[model samples]
Target: MARFRLLADEHQARSPLRQLWREFARQHSAVAGLALFSAFFVLAIIAPLLTPHAPYLQNDNLLLLPPSWSELGLVQYPFGTDDLGRDMFSRFLVGTRYTFGIAVITVLGALIAGLLLGTLAGMSRGVKSSVFNHILDLALTIPSLLLAIIIVAILGPGLLNTIWAIMLALLPQFVHGVRNAIAEQLNQDYVIAYRLDGANNLQVFRRIILPNIWERLTVTATMALSTAILDIAALGFLGLGAQAPTAEWGAIIADSLDLIYVAPIGVALPGLLIFLAVLSVNLVGDGLRTAVKKRREN
Candidate 1:
């Protein structure tokens, strides 16, 4: 009887997650986006094996070779070679790692910092909360990209610095979202019950508040991820990011401007990847929001 009851309890526990997956799967656009993003992730993981040549290796003889299918192209260079004769396809594959990796890292960093600050503000009152709220407002007043650029300029440009800049720029939104969510949750019946039951502030926050607000946080984090990607690309485009031979999508596009006419594929491929990545993340975020809403309604 005990084993049977345990099995039944486990099934019940699994039901909600299964329902959430069903809800997500019902969104065709979200599924498609997931597929696209998964493909890119796979490519990034297998890039070393897939790349035809070292991304930064320059072959003077193959300079500006168009894609293999192009009438003007060499069969050896599939997506073509850049002006410097580095393999476009190779650089692109490797770039998936840098571009997506940085975006994920930046978003996670911002989310952690924001969650801490927001939690503190939400749990406090009067002066402390006011200070946090005002700081968040001040941060929000600056345009995200411009704020990132300013930070990058001050920190000096590099992949790490760019990630930090973007993370800092994104922090305010997460903080604001979390703070509002926690403040609202604190007023809820469940939170009040927990408090009345002699739960400590930390206990109430951990067992009641965090779970209640996690769905909103998940949606916000996904949206923030897309913004981080775009910001990283923008920083790279402006010459304040990933640097030469680094194989970042925006940096590749920046370098290809002069070769636009000579080899349009060089410029278009990376831009297309960036577009697809951002679009995929946004689609996923929308799907998550819809699914969570439906879950709540049920």
Candidate 2:
């Protein structure tokens, strides 16, 4: 016991990620969040294959069936049916695709814009940085969600429209992250040495700044995805996102509001899906961040 205690103490001296996962593994919140999200993502990717019934197909007999503990007994619809008699489970499964789709595109697009603008701004001073930074500052000051609503209003409601809106709204955050990281590294000795070695500006950017900054943006991109997903759902709730019968998580919530009493899981199901999706991405992001920080420290 004494020797074991000494060894344990020595091992505990390592970085947090090494220690954190083991400690966090026992947590139901983290476990359930990861599992739920993985399952949800799989559902989204393989939606066409996994769904037992066509999500859009209507069955009057099964309309408004409550969540089934066992095959709906006689009704046979799982997790009941929506107002239009479409299977809630199947719609929810398919909706994962729509929700994740919007989130992924918006976040990825925003990452590109932020990374380019930020890299340029950070590597520069004088008027160039000022021009780019002013834009970033302007975006940062505005509320992203409100901006999304306005943009979506102009673009009109649709999956692609909401994605574009959210993508624009996400720009400021990436700019902030990218700018900070690049600014810190631009002044490093290695950067100056490379410049002195006759490396062209583009060459310097490719070799020096980007390699170091890549991890930051990667983690940021993942985190942004979570927010983007939420934003998409919000748009859906407001009827500014995926159209009806699209089975998006947010649209599901909007539809369920009218039928909350009749089929609560219609509400719960989508809500659960979104919450889990966001939570999982966040947890994984956290893990990655911790790992990165530890690497930097070491």
Candidate 3:
């Protein structure tokens, strides 16, 4: 028997292919997530072109028209009409913008805030850093929904307020994650040598640690987007999302609570779209994580 074993180049080539196959498998798990979310995104972008009727318009005569392929004139709606006779298809199309918009903006704001706070915490090791960490811990300890609800209740319901509430709620998680990543990266030999060679902390963080650990931060931020989308949808469903007549998915679900039992698809369509958006973001997060890990291994 050999004293030591050698891992050959052939084995390494096979490892990448295995990683590729695993990636493909991950992609397959996320098909439904992609399809539903893509439909909503495309619909939102082309709302004016795709909408058959104004999302806010109502025709009493056609109220509650069930989805029927044959009843073309009487019930032409594919997803059916709501109690107010608003076209389910059109509102659903229009709702995508508010929900997706909240997710994107809130997550971005939180990520930026987190980056700043986390950088400060990672660089300082004194009383101030300890105090900031405790604050982060306190924020994380509170239930996210409770925090959001409180913010909304205090500020009153509206798009801008809701975005602010969500950004505040999401900031702590980002801060904690980035802080950990930066702290770990700071321990590396390169950073140690740079510090010894007269590079200041800011220069090291800005040019060295940040660039290297950005991949990990991006992974967390992508997942955070999915969370923000869900939070916004919940707010809308609870009467805190976009105000009435704006055609938000959550607001539509809040209105159709009763009809959900009657048509099943009444509340389900918007709810399903919300679910799909979160799911798609989650899938993308998973795929990216795996890709990043594989890259690191190679």
Candidate 4:
């Protein structure tokens, strides 16, 4: 079996992505995490078509029903209903879209902003570098959640404002990490050789620095994705994000808290989703880091 697996891997090594997948699949936990995350993401994408009923529609007759597995469960209302008689299963499916969308948008926005700023800071000298360093230091002084709260407070509570706040709060981490990585690469022999070979700053950065730092940036971005999800959920839980009737994970959990005794699954389901999302992202990040380290050593 081992020999056949090795032969199969060698046969599939024609594509870089395939090779990376093989390496990544070696970690059982990472593969499991990826599967779980992908399943949720797919469910979120197709939620509108798959949801049994409108998430916001209320059915007073079915209020506080238990899950289908419970003795009190109804077949039509599989996951049960909220206090307001909204379908829990449908709302949960729809909520996945909101939660995943916010996390992806926030992380991508922060990553782009961080890349631009980090590159500038890393390439700058003397006063320019000093200024950026101080600014990053100031941003990093406060915790990300607190910073997000402050921004949200200033900007007023809303979904877009919450995303922007989370982006701002996460910006310093990417900037700092990327800046140091680029700075180190700048001093390397290849960079010096590129300069000696008459390569311009743009060429050097495009061909050399960017490729080398990509894996690190990917690792950072994956970890940041988890943080973004948590921050958005926190904001939603505190009434600063997504707002009411939006079917967001955190908001769902928050709204169901009052009915814990009557409908524990209402609270537990959303919370479980959040936990799984974070855990999957973290696992993928760890796997990427390990894979990158092994590749570098080889």
lDDT at position 287, candidate 4: 86
Better of 1 and 3 by TM-score: 1
Off by over 4 Å in 3: 1-27, 30-42, 70-76
For model 1, which pairs clash? none
Instruction: TM-score for candidate 1, please give it.
Output: 0.94
lDDT of 4 by residue, 1-298 (tens): 9999998877776555565666788999988888887887788789898889899998888889888898989887889999888999999999888887778888999999999999999988999799879999898899888999999999999888998999999999999988999999999998999999999889988999998898899999999989988988899999998899889999988898898998999889899999999999999888888877766654
RMSD (Å) per prediction: 2.7, 4.9, 5.2, 3.3
Best prediction by TM-score = 1
Candidate 2 wrong stretches, greater than 4 Å: 1-37, 70-75
- Once fitted onto the true fold, the runs of candidate 1 whose alpha carbons sit more than 4 angstroms away are 1-14
Each model's total of backbone clashes: 0, 0, 0, 0
Tens digits of per-residue lDDT for model 1, 124-216: 999877977898899899988999999999999998899889999999999999999999999898888889999998998888898788889
Q: How does residue 31 of candidate 3 score in lDDT?
A: 53
Range of the 10 consecutive residues with the lowest summed lDDT in candidate 2: 15-24
